[model samples]
Target chain A: AQSVTQPDIHITVSEGASLELRCNYSYGATPYLFWYVQSPGQGLQLLLKYFSGDTLVQGIKGFEAEFKRSQSSFNLRKPSVHWSDAAEYFCAVVASGTASKLTFGTGTRLQVTL
Target chain B: DTAVSQTPKYLVTQMGNDKSIKCEQNLGHDTMYWYKQDSKKFLKIMFSYNNKELIINETVPNRFSPKSPDKAHLNLHINSLELGDSAVYFCASSPFDRNTEAFFGQGTRLTVV
Candidate 1:
């Protein structure tokens, strides 16, 4: 079965601290990876995606993620956390040629503390 | 302007009542989808339509039906609503084929009484 996992249900980081959110996925074929952010009472917004080429991808709001094929991980990272960065982050995947049916992880809620 | 929009941002209905949620995307994308976000905040795909044709249907109840009048619109209708059916329904759209990122609507919160 294909699935995505976000090990941490919630994470807290003080403002200006480095942050990392872990994600792992199980898929049969080459995977199309994505990260989305959702704020309170708001819709999901695409942060970044990994399809091919470079393993490291940069996203909006100074966020970036690296795709590690060996470990089946695509962890999100940021050099410094901001209070506004506190939101629910989701990792999603779709099998190649699957017609955009995304398999989403359980999501990680980031709580930034000042 | 919203790239994707879903009508009835909040809906509260009685059990066994039928209701529908409409979705529209103006990004000129070829694919649309409906996702359910449960109380636990787990998001799951319910249906996918590409070019107004049903492409993917997950293990959803038969009471839930999705309709696509065009490539830019997808609508979901539920019959005989139940308590477990109360959830946040999100509509999203993406471009056709590989390496596409989906745009999501504000989501509709459904409550069953």
Candidate 2:
């Protein structure tokens, strides 16, 4: 079974400050990774995804994530976050051969302080 | 136009009542899924259907039934709802390929009192 672990339950970053959300996954082989954001009372939106080829994947709203095979991590990063970036971010993984099943981590609540 | 849409954005009902939530996707994706998001912001997959065929069924209660009449529609029906069943349900669809990303609906919030 593939599982995602987000160590930080809550993260607070000031506006214009850089941010990084850690995500670790447990999977036997190379897996498909994704980052999703959910604003309050809204559904989850795809931030980015990593399947093959490039180790660094860029997403909407100037967000990006790098897939590290050695560490089994796909951490989301943004150079400068805005106040509207505050939301719940989830890290998800789909094991090889399981295209429809997505295992998500307990979301990390981002708080952008001005 | 909404690529994925779920009816009754907000549903409030008492315990022991039966209710249903309908979902439709116009993306023409072959796979559709039902995901539950708890109050604590944890998401879990409940059911998935591909081309009107059931593919993934999680460890959900038997009271929760999902029906896919066609490739573009997947409806979830809950029987004898409990307080524990109160949560936000999201409908999502994606292409059959592994590299594709799933598009999610706004979600339907269900409250059982």
Candidate 3:
């Protein structure tokens, strides 16, 4: 079974500080990965995705994630986080085959302090 | 225009009452899905429809039924709603074959009293 794990439950960071959110996945073969952000009471918005490509993938809103096959990790990073960047982040992996189901992580809530 | 939209952004009803959440996507995607986000923000796939065909049905209860009138719409109907059913339900759509990124709706918050 394909699964995604986001270790951090919540994180607090000052404005303009660097941010890193950890994500790990378990799958038999190489899997498709994605990062999504959701604001309070809102739906999810796709930040970035990783298929078979360069390990470093850039996403919207000055966000990026690096996929490490050895560690089974896809960690999201940002050099400078703005206060408006505070939101919930989810890491997901698409199940193998044509089923096209997405297995999502528990999500990490980010709190940006001004 | 919204890529995906769900009706009744907020719903509050009593237990045993049946309710339906309607979803539509204008993105011309062939696949639509229903996901449930619990209080703890854990999202789980509930059902998936491709071109109006049921493709992925999770371990959801029989009381929950998903209907896809077409490739652009998928609706979720729940019978005998329980307090446990209270959560945010998200509707999403993606291309049928590639299945990389999925566009999600604003979500419908269901509250069962």
TM per candidate comes to 0.97, 0.98, 0.98
lDDT at A6 for candidate 3? 96
Q: Which ranges of candidate 1 are over 4 A from the true structure?
A: none
Clashing pairs in 2: none
| Tens-digit lDDT string for candidate 3 (B1-113) | 99999998999999999999999999999999999999999999999999999999898999999999889999999999999999999999999865468999999999999
After superposing candidate 2 on the true structure, give the runs of residues whose Cα lies further than 4 Å from its correct spot. none
Highest lDDT against the true fold, candidate: 3
lDDT of 1 at B74: 99
lDDT (tens digit, per residue) of candidate 3 on A5-77: 9999999999999999999999999889999999998999999999986999999999999999999999999
Task: Compose the digit string of candidate 2's lDDT tens values, residues A50-79.
Answer: 999899999999999999999999999999
Residue A102 of model 2, lDDT score: 85
> In model 3, how well does chain A match by TM-score?
0.98
Candidate 3 chain B: worst-modelled 10 consecutive residues by lDDT = B94-103
Candidate 1's docking class is high
